[model samples]
Target chain A: MSVYPISSPPSPQAVMDTSFWSLCCYCGLEPYLWKVWARPIWVPTVVKNQIFYHAGDYPDQQAFQQAEHEGLLAIRDPQIRITQFRSGEREVLSLAQEVSATALIDDFSAHRYAGTILGLDTVGVLEFLVSLLEAEIITLAQAESAYHQLVQLRATNQGWLKWAYNQIKQRGGNP
Target chain B: MATHPQLPLTPEEVAELHRLIAWTGLEEPEALHKLVEAGLAALRLEAALHLYATAPLSTGEIAEQTGIPRGQLIRTIQERRVAPYEDPTIDQPALYRDLDERLKRRVARWKGQA
Candidate 1:
């Protein structure tokens, strides 16, 4: 028997990944809430990637520094050689040797790498969220609500929404 | 070796031996041997003792309820003595009377110091 009844499924175009960027676009608005609520208890490899991705776009210097101090900026890709180019300085710090770079951008490269070049594993996020729901810290209904809100806020991707919906159902949500 | 003469049993003696063996009532040869060896008898005695200790019945009441022959009941009681108590009226007396006595002695020693 399910603990609670499932609400209507999330909108068809709710993108889970895009929600992070939406929050990033409005970084100074209220970064603390996402940091507290959304961030998993023990930072997984994927969550660490998301944190680094969010931190890379912050306009404020303090916010960027806060992210670094909180160990959000330490996660790195295994494949890439990250080098920091200091303005007007000949000494280029090889970030791979010093510590793994959280965010790396090359002008010539087609893709900007923030977080591990390995890409964020959404499975970990899904598992973490499902655990949170099972623990009753967040309800299945609340997750569905959040998903719909994210979709309305221009989050797009049917696959992510369906995946999340299935996860909730698997955890014994009555549809 | 010296040849020994075999003495014949009287009919009464043979009948008495048969009667004593017949009390076992076990059909199987193995069961009869076990009964003669007092294995099942010992287990039954232990179970009876446990019931006597835990059951809400006096020794006399248990003897009456079980219908164990009075002589056997007296012998069993003698073999398995009831735990000592300050007063016999108390129900389910503690298993360790000696330990309670030791504790009382320790308390007395401490009280003397104080």
Candidate 2:
């Protein structure tokens, strides 16, 4: 007899777990509709520099640890890009050979520094979230709830969530 | 018998007189004298109400019709001192229905054309 049956009896304990259970149920019910992995491009150096500068009052130890936890730093392969510039020219002469993903950043100075100086594609998180919401992978209610949670998290971490929320709210969502 | 010679009314003066008569409903000498001073203020409100009832007009159009400064009109509308016409896209037939119902109530009380 096969250990993994085609239709197995459902476990009651599995239903109560919101995180893994929801994902499992969604996958089991709609196997064709599941998105297993997101191929998100992470610009580690850019993220690390921004976090280090902007992470106020948090100890260097804690900030470094948090950055690792948040997957802001690349663990396995450290991809470093070196660029050379000529005198009196505003642009960089050369760029890195390999770039998997671009960083989404909010800080104006960091954005300008990365975009103009390093030639990286920097997008805002709220704009990205709006696009995700519009794509229907995430419902509007879910997006709103997640945004509220993110606001609280940002307030705890960065201390300007209220201003950020107000700005984003003023720019109406896609109808 | 009239003591003074009548002067022809300009288009603006005629329109202003019509608005004043619509608002005051008075033609007596005492009322006319009172209206000559307060007529513009009363007509200004009537003009606003007409605009509000009919459709949403631009600030420039409202200013041109009522002689109220656009800034003042905007401030009044924003502060809810005067209600503006609702946008057709957002409100649809419900806005017109509500306005019509309110006008009916006011006309019933006044026993006159609204």
Candidate 3:
């Protein structure tokens, strides 16, 4: 219910959703996203719980654990209580508010809540990819490849994916 | 060796996909995106029990206030015979049988590993 403004970007510490991390892992772009955009990313305790639940089963589990061990990603509990969103989204949004960090969320409703209601500068998977493209951290070919990977994973809604592709193209990315 | 998986679509298919993307309009209605604003489903049940005990409200009234379907409220209250303080939501018994079966299998696997 609390609103924050997106005009002045928050600190570079990224509070991300589990889905975004999973998508990055699927495309082998997790490290790239962290290094280029997140800049010492953090996960909410609930997100960490999801990671653990997927640890032995998911391909990205080791990367997440390794990131935590290396201090590139830290998992902390959200100070505020929120129940309207799913476990991961709720924790990430609260943590972002608690720390005044940028929110990198992908779920549509949760994304809207953070960006529109909370006034946090929010980034989605597409925006993160576009950032990589603009920064020249990822080649156009890599971006295209990652997009296909996302499609295969169905990590995002199909309609949103199409919209995101158009956004990327508008930004002069060759995708 | 291939460094990555092959592109799933052919060039023609990819262009067709681009065309499809263009055809599809963005901006879905906000109403379609709405979810319950607050309260975990489990906590809602717990709160309903507390209210029933404290307020002496009828079961139907509690169901209406809590947004729980009336029939489900009846079953939860009568069939489960849930105590006011006991947490019935600890196990998701209302989940689909298939999911419950799978979770049981997973817990069994973990138990065996231990």
Per-residue CA lDDT of model 2 for A51-100, tens digit only, reads 23333553432434543454332322233334331110111111112333
lDDT tens digits by residue: candidate 3, A34-139: 4433335888776766556522555667777777776667877787766556466777888888888778776555665676688776666765665556555578
Evaluated at residue B70, the lDDT of candidate 3 is 36
> Which candidate wins on DockQ?
3
Model 1, A1-175: lDDT tens per residue?
Answer: 3212223321111112212322332322223223223221122233233334333443333443454465332332233333322110001112222332111111111011222242311121322343345445466676555544433432222233345456567766642
Off by over 4 Å in 2: A1-97, A153-175, B1-114
What fraction of native interface contacts does model 1 preserve?
A: 0.00
Residue runs of model 1 more than 4 Å from their true location after superposition: A1-65, A75-128, A134-137, A169-175, B1-114
Residue B97 lDDT in model 2? Answer: 48
C-alpha lDDT score of every prediction, in listed order: 0.32, 0.35, 0.55
Higher-ranked by TM-score: 1 or 3: 3
lDDT of 1 by residue, B38-113 (tens): 6444434443444444444333334344444322432354335432112244332231242234334433432343
Q: What share of the true interface contacts does candidate 3 keep?
A: 0.00
The top-ranked prediction according to TM-score is: 3
* Worst lDDT 10-window in candidate 1 chain B: B84-93
